[model samples]
Target: MALTTDRPITTAGLAAQRQPERNRNVGRTLRRLPGYAAVALLLVVVTYPLIWLFLGSFKTQDEFLNNPTTSLPDSFTNFANYSQAWSSVATYLQNSLLTVLPSLALIIAFGTAAGFALEVLVWKGRQTTLMLFLAGIMIPGQMILLPLFTVYFQLHLTGTLWPLIITYTATGLPLTVFMMATYFRAIPKSVFEAATMDGASIIRSFISIGFPMMRNSVLTIALVQFFFLWNDLLIALTFTTDDAQRTVQVGLLNFTGQFGVVEYGPTFAAICINVLLILAIYIFLNQRVMRGLAAGAVKG
Candidate 1:
């Protein structure tokens, strides 16, 4: 049998005990109220634009002209704008894929190899070489644009996708190398050493061990480079002379003419499509990218 020395509590005593807890709870809620309000405001800030864009895509040019901001679409089922936009952007979409995909592959391939060699392999001057590569990151793209354009014009590569591909690959590689090198540095050198002792070649060791371990980091770099390439208008417009070679961003210009005439509905539709594509990609890979960034932060 269990015995307890206890005092019977009066109603007033229980109320006294609960009063402090209630006050403390109210105080905590009051303290947190501003944070909740800020989050709600941020949600509205981000969400309202997307909702507006979606609604605007369904509206007619007249509807937008009369009341662009306050008016809702007359019909949600209207899809004429999408058809018009798609017809114009189909080739542009293809061109973007062709250019961005190849550059992405080249960036990853060279970056990973450079990172592995720099961090995993024992060598003199590796740090100096890495510094040289990192220096590229600080150089602004605008500084090289005119020189690159002149060279591309001489080479007859201005109208082709080669300029875009080469530009993206070269520019993206330095940062990729930096990120990948940091990741590779965090890994144990002994792993590569053991692989070496087991008769594995450096390439084999990188392939079998290094690449697999840094998959998440690779994805992060790919996503970043993809976004940069996909949304680029300045470079695409400067290099691409032909309509067939234009990117999606450039293709969106088709809906506007020189006389101040703009096809607002179709333009909004195209913008929506472009944004949704990138948004879908981000949503799919967001978790992995977050994990990679978190791992890098912890390792650093």
Candidate 2:
């Protein structure tokens, strides 16, 4: 009889056996190199203007004017442009904060409450109310511009930040409500039922349990509203006639006008500053925004 032998498969032997498969995968990856290269090229093309704008911010007026095609500035450390730009728009920046902060607070507070009431609480006309809110989203902002302006003008609010605040808050509501409601709906009905059994009021349940559970949705709403209010030029321009009440967008436009001739360095620097502020906010809250959106999508 032939001797029977059995050997355990060693790690090295297993790896050797898989080597061909690994090599095939690598070969497939290599075959996709042209696609990767094209994507990289596309990214560079899309980003080049922003990069140029940032680099141009560092150049002196003369350097920017004389060497429009040049990519680098003579002195990267020169911050005079930024200082000048800030000096020009400091009050406008303050006004922006004043307008946006309160509007944002209202948007989150009322939006979440409305969403909870619609989704978690049993009520008459809930579906109708939700339909109304959702319908508002379909209305064109431009369609209301003339009527809104007339109303604000009659109220003598045209030159003040109040109109901007009110408009921002109002325009932001439909989307906020929709997002929050979608998020709230994804929550199990049993959660609210348990609260009801415990003698918890709708307000109490919303404040305690709902708020904590919907943190991601709240962040998403906040981020969206923040960007809208911060970057708003059309509303700001239409509503605010006072220089002191101008937000950053109108302020930037005025900055160009104040110089009579455009000062490219300071203009670019101001643009860079605005872009950086938005970019910083996005970077900081990006994870939360993604989480909120994903959670809402999955749950809704």
Leading candidate by TM-score? 1
Candidate 2 all-Cα RMSD: 3.2
- After superposition, the stretches of candidate 1 with alpha carbons farther than 4 Å from their true spots are 1-5, 257-260
Residues 141-198, candidate 1, lDDT per residue (tens digit)?
8898899999999998877899999998999899989988888878888898899999
Give the number of the best model, judged by lDDT: 1
Give candidate 1's root-mean-square deviation (CA, Å): 2.3
Candidate 2 per-residue C-alpha lDDT over 1-300 given as tens digits, one digit per residue, 9 for 90 to 100: 888697899999999999999999999999999999999999999899889988888888789667756558988898998988888767878999999999999999999999999898888999999999999999988888789999998998877788888999999999999889999989999998999899998889999999999998899889998998899888888888878888999988977645487888888888888888889989999999999988888544
lDDT of each: 0.89, 0.89
Mark the regions of model 2 whose C-alpha exceeds 4 Å error after superposition.
Answer: 1-19, 257-259
